[model samples]
Target: MQPAMRSLSPLTPSDYHAHGVCCCGTPLLQHFHERMMALFAGLHGPETVSASPRGQDSPLLLTNLRLFDGSGAPLRDNVAVRVMEGRIQAILPGDAEPEGAEMIDCGGRVLMPGLIDAHWHTTLAAITQAAAMTADVGYVHLVAAREAERTLMRGVTSVRDVGGPAFALKRAIDEGIVAGPRIFPAGAMISQTSGHGDFRMRHEVPRGATTPLTEQERQGVAAIADGEAEVLRRTREQLMLGASQVKLMAGGGVASTYDPLDSTQFTERELRAGVQAADDWGTYVMVHVYTPRGIQRALRAGVRSIEHGQLADEESVRMMAGEGAWWSLQPFLQDEDSNLYPDAARRESQRQVAEGTVRAYEMAQRFNVNTAWGTDILFNPQNTPNQLRHLAKLTRFYDPLTALAMATGRNGELLSLSGPRNPYPGTLGRIEPGALADLLVVDGDPSQNLDFLADPARHMRLIMKSGRIHKDRL
Candidate 1:
């Protein structure tokens, strides 16, 4: 179904220049309107897309606001944050409001760094039929723009995308032609035959003869290999495709029908070869591990992080720490409109996902494991609509501020982002000077009352990312 697009004038002169799409002037905006209309049709029904007032359309000053920097700390009230040139200039007490700066009174709302999604999949058209997309490059780029902006609307300004559908989505975001999070993409995930990511396979061949291999199937995925050389080669292949890091099917998963959760697919030699490939390129390798053997092997192989570690006990967790490994945990919280997975396999997958999350949480808390936070949603696009549901984990068990840190500063550290003093403008996750102005302002105090975390659409009144106003309810 085609989407409905609105034909409207540019909200501001700067918005026209900011897009860098059409040539300057009213005629250009008309062409832009037509292009956007075409983009809307590609995304689906017009209802899925929205045009937030751009550039000067968003008010500048957010005065008299309460703020939380996503660190576990006390909230500051009557504070003001100044954003200019896509970077945070200053953060000061309430009295520091700038004059003639389009003052937007935040009314004691709690402001924070814009949310980040640690692990996500936006490249696939549908998770089950993902392989079909290997044949499409143009359509994939067309869809990624809508997928990313949808993530932005959910208040996500950054993401660490674990592999799927290659690097097309990441390129679209970085090139400034689309709207989405600051994407750190791990291009393609490496997996052995019958491993977690090798979910399906097909071939076309002459009649009455053995099926012939299609080029797409060989290059797109199913990068199964048993030897160290092959593993190293495949890892390099992904890096060459513009991956920021590397992802491996370290073990089985609930999503892959072919792989068993506890079975180890790659040998220690092959795993280490993959890690060596990433390290040579100055990138980190993360593993999809749900069992002890996979976890142990990843640690032995010198991979940097582990995900979905359902079977990690005291021994496994300690080994990771000794090896300087990080863990990415998602708090699915089990009961948040989980009915979104109505199919039997998906429902079963949901159960496994929930169990894995809880187990991951318990291990992190008990062992004080070096960990980061993320919502491993987005496999289903519908899940994006209720993205705030994952925040309920903060309110229910952990404190909200700690939850926020897992989403923000901690992720920056995991991604190895440098401090404010770095020579080439490193990413600072805090609200201090030199931090990227990726911030969120809410209507209520989130520290004492965590439920404010759940209702993002209502409570988050202002959303700023790198000095850009994606959403403003002030």
Candidate 2:
């Protein structure tokens, strides 16, 4: 006699939360539950279908494609990829057929690992700094949700948010409440009083005054800590809230009003406190620093990554290389779309950093330092759409292939520095078997013509993150 077929019921919120933790203790159940919900909603088209009822394991096969693989090696033609259970299962010959898999013909398109942004700020999505400062907290997050979706559609599948209150947004995207990139949130930036992260109005008194904290501080976007004990406390708070890494303001910044670009912030002891706290949590500390002295100080304090070291000298670059620290440099062009600060001093500071970009890249190459790329798009919703264009700017210093690798494999290596605190494990930034299936299919070869990357909506044929198809033009 034939056995009766069993039907499964829809998953409830409580059921999802109960099974949300992965065997590795990663928070992945929510993502699995959401994929199941997407299958039930009939949102995915025939070209992209959920392979299983549980939605955690899906089999997808793409054939007849040119593969870049994100390895910085030569491109291979007529390649095929098999993704199962949210990871790459094999790199097969193009003509080989796989069993029990939904197949998609790539039409000889270019398949590569998805792009990654090493430095991003999810909470600061306003068109201007003033606007970001004045916008309602709830409204800002709403804008962030839209921005995150747009970012993913543009071919970037993951980001390391160096600053902002991104814990909530990260949870939302991870749980499948929204469609967006995977986030490695740094939580609020730990800053010294009157430092780069401080965004208080001119008339407002400093900390310890009768007045309360600034709106940004109150919203957990940035925290001002004065001494070693306070810095340790603030850093621990972010780790407790699930930050994969810690961010500190080791030097002044262009956007900040009170500090000049050349000034260094935070004492050595205070910076060490943050590093120690992050180390205790099985992660590392990345600092926002630019000048040579600032970089040296941060290196001495055990910082593992240096953001925006455009003004660092040769010695500092050598020190960074010797310490095996990551240089998360931004490609700041002096074009019209560049940051236009209203304050004259701030504008000059921005210009100074822009002027140092070429020299920084040169120094990085001279010392053979490990460098990564990021858009560093903040407080400018209008410019956010041009994020990929910033990657093209790297061609000024490197070939198309090398520049693409900087944004992919090199950036992926830096993201893994979080060690045991890394949220989404497995390999990233490459298209090898066993790597996470965050990938893109482009209409043209980005290795030869990077112009296609500037407009992903027009040239990107398919976008997949963790075996789930987000966009499929083919």
Clashes of each: 4, 0
Q: Count clashing residue pairs in model 2.
A: 0
Q: Least accurate stretch of 10 residues (summed lDDT) in model 2?
A: 1-10
lDDT (Cα, tens digit) per residue for candidate 1, span 137-252: 55555555676776776677877778765455556555555567777767667787667766454332121335443333453544555589878888888777767778888887
In model 2, the Cα lDDT at residue 57 comes to: 62
Q: Per-model C-alpha lDDT, please?
A: 0.66, 0.82
Best by TM-score: 2
- Model 2 misplaced stretches (Cα beyond 4 Å): 1-56, 209-211
After superposition, the stretches of candidate 1 with alpha carbons farther than 4 Å from their true spots are: 1-61, 97-102, 125-137, 202-222, 332-353, 417-425
Question: Where's the lowest-lDDT run of ten residues in candidate 1?
Answer: 417-426
